[model samples]
Target: MKTFTSPALSGLPGLRHAFFTRDGGVSKGIYAGLNGGIGSNDDPADVAENRRRMAEAMGVDVAHFLTAHQIHSPDVAVATMPWSPEARPRVDAMVTATPGLALGVTTADCGPILFADAKARVIGAAHAGWKGAFTGVLENTINEMEKLGANRADITVAIGPLIRQPSYEVGAEFVARFTEADPAFARFFIPSAREGHAMFDLAGFIRMRLQRAGIVDIDDTGIDTYPDEQLFSYRRTVHRKEPDYGRQIHAIVLAR
Candidate 1:
């Protein structure tokens, strides 16, 4: 299957990880390629097989490739072992110190961020959509990692493919939320041609949040998912009036 690896995470020791794309799987149509989203309308067997491929690629067993039912909240789960798909928690992020278990999150246009502190052997994965990020998912994920012995100073984060600012136009109220949170957030929004609408720099805001959280190392792929046909995109699908869109998986694991 086609996948992208973060150079930041690659040099880290005792870790295996990947940000998978929509390619090289048995799925067909819009869900074609390795669609690992268990919540999509795609056939369960197909998603299962796709995730199985991802598991093998990440050097984990099928049962060890874990993900959660994301609720766009600040909730973060700690994984000691993989939960059955039906049993996954309603959380937007996860952290793990356990070896051989892969922690993953699914996304289309939303941000998929992977974190690791090599010395601590702790890894984290977060689904940072505007809601989750605004609600503090990234910070909570790091806090959970600290509970597992990770250090913020030693942590390195890699932001995988996501919808860049140009493709992320938003309503005034949406902009209001951030500006209300902190006046500085206004810098992340640029005025759009449409009155009261603005383009948002989602990836940039995420990077800023990571930095403020005290993480010393950060890598942004700077790949825009909406314009890149190689990656799946929720906003793209909506604009095209597609019935459904598939999600891609971003995962990290502690090597066995």
Candidate 2:
């Protein structure tokens, strides 16, 4: 099967990003192939080798790849240049004005949003899980990109590999959180099987947030991680009573 990836990375002027699927790596068992999550129980050597392969594919220095601590918070990181791999930054979104530094973020079921403004020569990658989305991580990423000269109108945003609404059954408490965030959000939830559970549209909510930020070139590929066995899924893994799951990486680099 073909691995799922973001098309927004294609044809951009000196920019690169991939929504790497679960293929072409050394991790065995549940981690299987292309398992890039360092946080996962996958072997450190396998994880490092997988990261090296992704960097080589993106045409950047394997040493220059940067990712966050990812607390599911809304904080954003602005990269001045290549960050040391030894320093794990504690932020969800990474915006880079300096070229050639690949900003990487991991997701198993959360939305990995890639941003690029050809005119501004800027790119950003964000890990927006439910909590981060509710707290405005997407908005913060866009705002930080603008600080580096990307106009919202000129920026193109693409959301990659997520558990679609049909596969994402949430509890009433989850539905209530959005309703409390904004009554308009109540509409984003649809009735699901079983009482007190609703189907949440994660990608739709992401596009809505981007549109609200005035970026509407939304490319939602409709890839559902939970149902697709090729890629990993946190929820699906949990539902299957698995011990742990791998995380795919969404990374972007801008050439200076």
Candidate 3:
């Protein structure tokens, strides 16, 4: 039931952020409480309740809640009410300077990042999976917030619970992707127990990327999804052959 509200962003009274764990919902078994994804096998009622509670916890109306279709792309969307829950946009990042909107991102071993520049009243949330991160979702999200009047330097951000370095082993080809992008990133990977494979530090690489983006306020609580029983993990569930899995939610809201 632990909630991680980064001290880095806590000084911004105008912003609300929550890195929720698996403790507050009605879901059971693999999709236990607070499972918000309707796409999962969790009961529709449970999913609805999870979303309802998440919105309530953040003190925003459920309808003000916003998220993308989450294609793992770097695209960012500006939130406008007359909200469209029906037409999910094919994007993984969302930003808004407008008040009364809750920008959200879902994750299961992938990074969920919440950003805020209270001075400009701009906020953003991004789903930065490895693929999305590789494609520059973090930078794109910061760019979107800037478009809405945020200064990247002033924007405080917290990267929430995700798979950690030791828990994330990948093949050499995968390691090649980052090295290919920028040879400097090669240091983030180290040889794992498996042959030709290495353990990748996703959060560390993201921090480096954000730092390169000129963002100063950055931090991660270092919660690992794969080993943590509370947080949901797609990779963990898949390897276990579980029928379905739940998604952990990471959300931020601008005070009304």
TM-score of each: 0.98, 0.96, 0.96
Candidate 2: tens digits of C-alpha lDDT, residues 172-228:
998988998789998788998789999999888988888998996777778899999
Q: Which regions in candidate 2 have their CA more than 4 angstroms from the true location?
A: 1-3
Task: Give the clashing pairs for model 3.
Answer: 25-33, 25-34, 27-32, 27-33
By TM-score, the better pick of 1 and 2 is: 1
Clash-forming residue pairs, model 1? none
lDDT, candidate 3, 1-256, per-residue tens: 5577787777787888888888889998889777877568888888888888888888888887776778878888888662766776779999888788888888888999889998899999999989888898999999988988889878898988989998999998999988998899888999999899999999998898899899998978888999998889998998999988998778888887
Q: Model 2: which ten-residue window has the lowest total lDDT?
A: 1-10
Compared with the true structure, model 3 gives a TM-score of 0.96
Ranked by lDDT, top first: 1, 2, 3
lDDT of 1 by residue, 124-241 (tens): 9999999998889999999999999999999999999999999999999999999998999999999998998999999999999999999879998899999999899999999999
Best by lDDT: 1
**Residue-pair clashes per candidate, as listed?**
0, 0, 4
